[model samples]
Structures are given as structure tokens and as C-alpha cells.
Target: MKPTLRAALTSPFVVFTVFMLGKIYLSWFVIFESAFSWLPLLTGLPTVWAAFAPIELFARKRKLMLYMIVNVVFTSVYFAAIMYYKYFGVIVTYHALQQVGQVTEVKGSVFSLLHPYFLFIYTDIVLFGLLLTFRRTFRSWAVRGMTLNRAAAGLIFPLALMVSIFCMWTNRDSINEIKQAQHMGILNYELYAIFAKRSEPLLDESEITAEAIMKAKGLAANPSPNYWRAAEGKNIVVLQLEAFQNFLLGLSVDGQEITPNMNSLMKQNFYFPHIFQMVSQGNTSDAEYMLNTSFYVPPYGAAAQDYGDRALPSLPKEFRGIGYEALTFHTNDVVFWNREELYKALGFTRYYDKSFYGDADTVAFGASDEVLYDKTVTEMARLQGEGKRFYANIISMSGHHPFNLPDRKKKIELPDRFDDTLVGDYLTAQQYADYAIGQFIDKLKETGLWDQTVLFIYGDHMGLPIYSLSSKEHALMKDMLGRDYSYPDMLNIPLIIAGGGVTSPQVFPQIGGHVDFMPTIANLAGISLADHLHFGQDLLNTQHNLLPERYYLPSGSLINDTTIYVPGRGYADGVTYALPTGDGAMPSEDEYKRALELLHMSDSYVNQLPKHD
Candidate 1:
């Protein structure tokens, strides 16, 4: 070949080869981090480069620009949506963007934009910069001779290579940070996709039968069955208090309790004083799924919304089978979590939301707790008077985020601490809920229906941060609990079972989640649940421990006894000196392998459920 022709062919080839190598380097970096090992360095680099070589030939300036722009924009928008939903329980759209400026730093920008979801955007930006450099070099070469001299070229490629290697070295550390942040935010979509595709057998009849036998044998040994059996024919009412917490349970102003009604009710109810809710995907709706369906939320994606049509056995369904008029009442938009569809599928005969009752006097996201409770009580009485058994789930709205209540000065007095502040306002709302609940119960008593009614109340999720609160408010919480503030505690709302006939108040000690309510209540009411394999066990059943088993997408599967966190490959389990485990360490390899097998089995079971359906 001629010298000039040879150089022309070889120059682009050299740049293309370098670019290909860089791409290979990036892929290997991801693999290395994913594997949690340097093992990928030995095999992935050269193999990936060879596999990607053809794409290098087509790398042109225009093509590179388009690719960079698309990836950057796509990734940025994707991450922004994730973050927006994480903080506000809503997505960012063109209409939402218009209102973005109205929100404060903590509420909108700082809280939403600074989250780990933004890391994906940052990764996209880095990729864009790399693409731009390649594009600029190619453009310069196409117009004239390559701009970099032999010395510059030698320095540039080697420098790029070195930096690329350095990035690869640190990628694992970076991913660890990303994983922590991602877990705190919304569900991890990529992780869900991985496990969903791995086909495994669903829970077989033998397994369930064995588990049932174990549960039954254990239950027979307990004396609480009589209390549970006596709970029949009582009207069951569950109040899913949005963003409530035990902190609120103790919160008092000037020695006067904020939740006076709750305090009084606690004295008369079967309260699980230290009950911990085992959550799946972090969201109000997913909590509802866990609480109602007793099925595990697939750690990534919108499982509640995605599985809306899936046949899942629920408490309402069990109640309906026993001649009860099952109903669900929500203050917010029923369509928000696809609750309208999901509720009906779960066998709620009558569904009520903002549309059902006009939104003119609604508070926060929907109707005030007072109004919702008043209406629900009225409906419950109406149904009961008609000689029908009733199961009504009333979801409160006043305690939701941006915790604002409409101006209504009831007979109850607000404490001096509940001034015009966010936390104060939130407390005031809780007070309102307590008052409404108290009134509802009083009305039931007037009708002589109090003895025949069962009341269940718990929080939906944790409260969001109130920017207006002093650093001291945040500090008090952190000091009392040595961790970053979370919405989960707020989600850990008090669950009380109260009625005139509820015998003695006893605190159940096992760890139970929202999902447990269905099975627990159903079993107590002597209702059989068919077509659903629930992950939640009855808390009232003292035989089997309702262990908290969490499937954290992309990495870990945590059962109360063991936590298997695998950022990448072959797997390593260590023992820790934590409860469940004697030394707060991870399990041994043999233990880990066993745990992994169980997780795989669980995943297989979840995946196979739909096929059976």
C-alpha cells in the first residue's frame, strides 16, 4: 500500500482500535464491579474488545454525537423521574416541571436531584464526555491530518488508557455507594429483571403442606386460639394510617399527649408494642400489597401495579366469602396505585375515593381523616344494620406528606407546641385522626355495635422530611435512633386490635408486616384463603415465627436469620454479631450456599405463580 493511503487507513484504524479498547475497558469495569473481583480483568477485557471491534469501524463524528445526546438525555430523564417519585411519590413531567420552581431546596431540588438516582445521570454525562472527545478527534482528522502529533498521540492514548484503568479499579467502591442509595430510593428495575427471568418452580403443594403442618402443630401448642376464635362476628375495621409512627404514640405537648384517643384505645386494645414491619419495595402502595396480598413485592419495578390482574387471595376476599360486605375506602385518587383495579381484584365490592366523595373539603392528598372516618363509620353502620357482616378498610389521608389540614377548630384544643410548623401540623393531623377515630367508636357504642366491631389501625409508611423543622428536631430523632431518618418508622404505625369482647390486651412479639393482617384476620374469622401463597404468616399464631425475609434487588436477600448480600459473583458469607446470628457476622459458605438456594427457590416460586395462573 502507498505511504499516504497506508497512513490514512491506519490512522483511523488506530483511533478506532483505541476507542474499541476503551469500550472494552468500560464493559470490563462494570463486570469487575458486578463480580466483586479482579477476575474479570483476566478474561473480559480482550474478549469484549474482540467482540466489539466491528462497532469501532462505524464510529463517526455525527453518529457519536447522536449516540451521546440520546444516552445522556434518556439517562437524565430516567433518573430524574426515579428521584422525583422517590421523594414526592409522583413522577416529574412537563406539567410537574412548571411547578418545580415553587418547591423549596429540601422539598424539590436538593432532596430529589442529589439522590443516588442522579448517579445514573452522572454516569451518562461521563459517557457523553468520552463520546465528545472521540467525536472531536474524528472530526479534526477527517478535515485535516490528525491534530495530535506523534508525541501528543503517544501521551493521549496512554493517558486515556491509564485513566480508564483507574476508573475500573474504583468502580466497585463507586457501585457500593450507588447500591446503598438505590436501595433507599425506589425499587431497582435491573435487579428485578435479572431474577424474574430465572425460571424456578413455584412453591409446591408438598412444601406448603409441610409449612402448614408446622404452623398448625405450633399453633395447637398456644393458648391464644380461644381469643382469636372469640373474635368472630365482630365487624373488622382496619385504618391504614398514612406515614404514622410510634414516635407519635409518645409525642406529647406540655405533658398532654398528642394522640389522646390513641392513648386511651391502646389501654383497651391488643397492641404489638415492639412489632417491626418487614417491608419489600419501599413505597406506600407496596406496603399495602405486603399487608393485603401476603405476597412479596418483586424488589424492582411496580409490582403492585404490574400484578394488579394476578389472582391473589386477600382479607377482603376471605371476608366476602363469609357473607360480609367487603369494602375499601381511600381519601386519595384510587387510580394512583391502580388501587381501583387492584382493590376490585382483591374482592372489595364497594370502592370509595375522592371521586366518590367530593374533594371540595379534602386535606393534603385527599379527604381529611375525620371526614373519611365519619363517612366510613356511616357506611359500616348502614351495612351492619342491614344484617350483613362487614369488613371495611379505611385509609387515612391527613397524615400524608406536606402534612397540611384545613382550618377546622373542633372542640379539641391544640397544644402550644403545635403551632404553624410542619411537624406541628403533622402532629395536629394525627390528633385529628385520633379524634375522628374516637368519635367513630363512640357512635358505634351509641348504636350498641361497639362490642360487635373489631378495629385494626396501622401506618402506611414513614413521613417525609419537613424542611421547616429545626436541625434539633432532626438531631433528637438521630440521637434516639442512631441512623439516618427514614420513612419506614413513620410507616411503622401502631397496630391496635380493640373491641369490648377482646378479653385481655397482650403484646405479640414476632416480626410481622402489613401482609400478615390478611392471613391473621382471615384465620381468626375462620375463613379459608385459596389461590394465594402468602409470604406473611399470622402474627397471632405463636407457633411459627413470622421472620422478616427481604429480597433486596440486584444484591441481597435478607431473611431474619441470614442476610446474603452479593454485589457480585461466586458468593461469600460471613458471620456477624447480630441477633438471629450469634456474632453480628454473615453466615458460612455452606450456609450462604443454602440461603442462596432458598432465595433462588423463592424467586422461582414467584416467577412460576403467573404461569400456574
Candidate 2:
């Protein structure tokens, strides 16, 4: 018998209710197995009712098809949320919508995280469709008269909206975005995203008075006027590496060197062993912006997309002041991630992207590192002959995630333990990356520009995750390090200063971030930034270092000399762990307070500023 109007109202709603709760449980199981927060499951009921409530007006076939469509959309979102959480350790936000350009560069890493098990989310709809399509008896249910169930329909919309309001009120003071997201559930979070518009400003715009600037300067290190800028008039060459972490620096397998070129350069240049990445949503672009401006990245979307129109005060602008032409070179199209506008905001004299180089060698979805360097050096040489002082920013890409390279260029012979493993593939690609960068350095020397140019070589961000490793691999890594490898180790990237007048090698043992890049470079170039609204300190002169973490870690988390403190939900429930050891302990209150202050001030400064036309 065909089901009645009452059956239509109640039947699919029951199935949808199951799908809704099941998906939430699945999302929980994926991220933290055997652990869950039940509130989102409970809170999501109203949304399910709201969804199915509108279905009564349509015929049964249309209703079933529409319900199947809803399942598809939600399944996709929850699956994306699962993948996002696995990689970033945070709930995916609406801001990620703008990051599609990055998918091509990071697909290897992304695809690695995804497994066939994710298909379970859609199984309910698939089974429902199959049952209806194959069974002639079930098809009778599809022709249920197009009738409105006023009693059921009248209640769902109002109840959903009202419950959503209650969830919002309950989560109002939950300022921690992650905590708030968990409490409200997926459907409610999307609603919150719409209403919240943006986060509340951490500080009043009027509070950035002279005293605030004085307080900011007080929190940072006092720089020696010309301690580092002795190479004031030299040309600048900066290498911004992608997914290049410091773990592979001295790593060797089967007695072969992983990075013979960078290893040799660190012996004679200024190498920072403790610099951490501080990029926000912009990632690589954020790194470039921070390296030049000494300013915080926008807390929301990428600065390239959101603040690309602003007249950003940057290193390029500083170079332009002294008759130097500032240029940047990337292997991808200049328009990727809206970088063309970013270059404009940062004031680059010219940008050399894919259009400038021929397609002889391509890797990592773009031109190879070999092409990037050869063309960049050739152009720099021409500019030098033309008597143009230049600041050339070169961004490298070969060592990017999913780190697999062409088999011909795979030089490493991995032990059976690492064969076909993520880390093993990463090492092979990095070896190639090292070889490419080495060629560039050699060419610079061959052209006699090595001594005349000051090169700042540094990593853009962390590439690998400890969670991606198997137990054996993790144990092997621990054995290699002779200790527990944690956040500090994973986030550490190489920062080298070569050919800038120092006769011997030196290593800065202090911790720093990209925020300090311009200040340090400015000091070396004899350009003072004491009067500017800068957040970073010159690491060359500081004895104490404090850096607040963002993006990868929870808000209010910070790193100091001996500890890396990551909060559970907020500052009150935070845990501090010793560096490289992963031993839990209490953090220093004074330094931690200072770090939070810096984060707040930076957020305040950026958010309160007006966007330029």
C-alpha cells in the first residue's frame, strides 16, 4: 500500500534524523576516535526537522530525490570538515572557501589524508535510492498525492529558528572559535558564520595612542643602530621555500646526504635554528607580507584577498626608497591567490611569474625550481648590468607536499621501512629541491653576484605532521632525534643569511617568526623601523624571545625560551610543554602574558585599520 501523508511526514524525517546523528558521530570518530561531544548531535535535530519539513508539498519521488540531494551536500561538507580538522587541527571555517587556489598546490597532502572510509557518509542516501529504484513495490510510495502536511510543516521552521537562537545565546561568551563551534554543531555554526559577520575587535581603535606605541616598543627588543645593516648597499636575494621544514636539514639515509648544498651554506652563513612560521590564512603570501611589512596578517581571509588594495608598508617599498627596484619571482601564474594585487599592495617594481619563463622544466604543478632560479638569476644579472639596484624575492615550490617527484629525479635509496612512505617520498623531493637551490647559488657565484648580494633564505611553513606517521615511523623519528618530537620540532624551518659581509658562520639560537623578518633585514640594510607600527623585534640583538601561535595551534598559545604552551579550550585550561621533549609543565606567567598582549595588539592594529580603495 502507498504510504499516507502522515507516513510521508514521519518516515524520511526518521531516516534524516538517523543520517544527521550518524554523520556527526562519524565526524567525531574520524578526528578523535572513541571520543565525542554529544551536544552538536542533540543541537542538530532542529535543523533536520527544518530540512524535511518543507518536503511534504512535493510528490514522493521529488521528495526522495531532494532528500538525497541534501544528503549529498551535507556529506560533502562533513567530509571536508573531517579532512580540514585532520590537517589544520581546527574546524573548517567559511574563510576556507577562498583557499581553492591552494588545492592544486596541496592536493598531494590532501589526498593522502583522505581514505575510502569517507564514503560511509553517503551510503544512507545511496541505499535509499537503490531501494526505491529497484523495487516496483517501493515505487508506489513515490506517487503519494502532492499534499501539504500543515500540522507537521507549521512547526518545523519556527522550532528550528528558535532552537538555533538558544544555541547562539548559550555559545555567546564562548569566544574561542573552536570551542564555540563544538558547542553549536555544524548546522548552527553555518548559521553563526552568517550572523557573526566578523569577530569582535580585541581592542578599541582609539586605544592605539602614543602610549600604546610606546608600550609596543617596550615589549620588543632594543636594536643596535647598525649592528646588522653593514651590507646597506648590497643587492638582496630572498628564497621563500614552500613546505620546507627544518627536520630534513641534516637528515641522511643509506649514508647519502639529503641536503648537501644547504648543509654547506649554513657552515659559512648566519643560520637560525629556531625560527617558526607565523602565516595566517594567506600562507605563502602571508609569509611574504610579514617578511616585508613586519605587520600581522589579517585575522580573517588572506591579506592578499582582503587587504590587497591597501598601501602596505613593506621591504619592497623600503628598497624603492633607496633607488632599488624590488621584484618577486614565482613559478605559478602571477594571478594565483590574487598575488598580482598583493604585489601592488606591497609595492613590488615588477613580478616575474610563469609568463616570464619558458616551459622547459615543470614540477609541482608549475615550473620546476631549476627554471625558477635560472630565469630569475639571468634577469637579475641583466638588471645589474643595467645599473639597477634590485631586491629580488624568489619563491621555491619543488619540495611542496605529497613530496613525490619524478622517478628520474628521485635520488634517495630509502630503507625498506621508508619505501613508498610519506616521509621517504618527502626526502626524495627535498633532495631535488636542494639540488635546484644549490644550482642557483652556484650560478650567483659564477656571475660574481654572490658577494655583492645579501641572500635571505628561509622556509614558508611546516610541511609534515606527526599524526601522518605510522607507529614504526614515529618511533624511528623519535630514535633519530633521541627525544620526543613535538610542535616546536615540526614547525621549525631553516632561515639562512648568506653573503652579507660576515667572514664566518654564525647561528642564532633564539626563537623568532616571519614577523621579525623585515626588522632584521632592515637592520642589516641600515634602515631603521623604530618609528613604524611593527610587531616583530630584531632577533640579532634580543636575549629573550616570545611568539604567539596562530592557525596551527589554539589561540593564546605561545612559545618562549623553554616552553610551548597550547591551550585546551582557552587560557584557563592550557598546558605547557618543554621544547623538543614534549614533557608537560607550567609556563612562565610573565612571558606568556606578554605574548598574549602582542597577539591582541597585532589583531587590534590590523582589524581597526580601514581598507584602501
Please give, for residues 1-613, the per-residue lDDT of candidate 1 as tens digits. Answer: 8877667655543443444333333332332224334433333333332222322334445534443443444344445544554444333334344334324412522352353433643553575477557776644443353322445444444554444344334333322223322221111222222333333456564565324533422233333444455567777777777767766775666565777877777777787643444443335666666667666565334455556666656777777777788888887778776676677657677888888666766666666766777777777777778998888877776666655555672334555444544556666667777777788778778776677877777776556442223455565555444654443343244677788446887766444556567777766666655455665556677433323233222333333322323333233422222332223455445444443444444444555544212
**Model 2, span 500-592: residue lDDT tens:** 666678888877889878878888788777556777777777655667777676566777666778765556667776764334466656555
TM-scores for all candidates: the values are 0.66, 0.89
At residue 533, give the lDDT of candidate 1.
61
Q: Please list the residue runs of candidate 2 whose C-alpha ends up more than 4 Å from where it truly belongs after superposition.
A: 1-10, 33-40, 43-46, 53-61, 101-109, 131-167, 201-206, 209-226, 467-473, 580-597, 603-613
lDDT score, candidate 2: 0.75
Please identify model 1 stretches exceeding 4 Å from their true place.
1-71, 74-226, 253-256, 280-282, 404-429, 464-473, 479-491, 528-533, 543-546, 549-613
**Candidate 2 weakest lDDT stretch, 10 residues:** 139-148
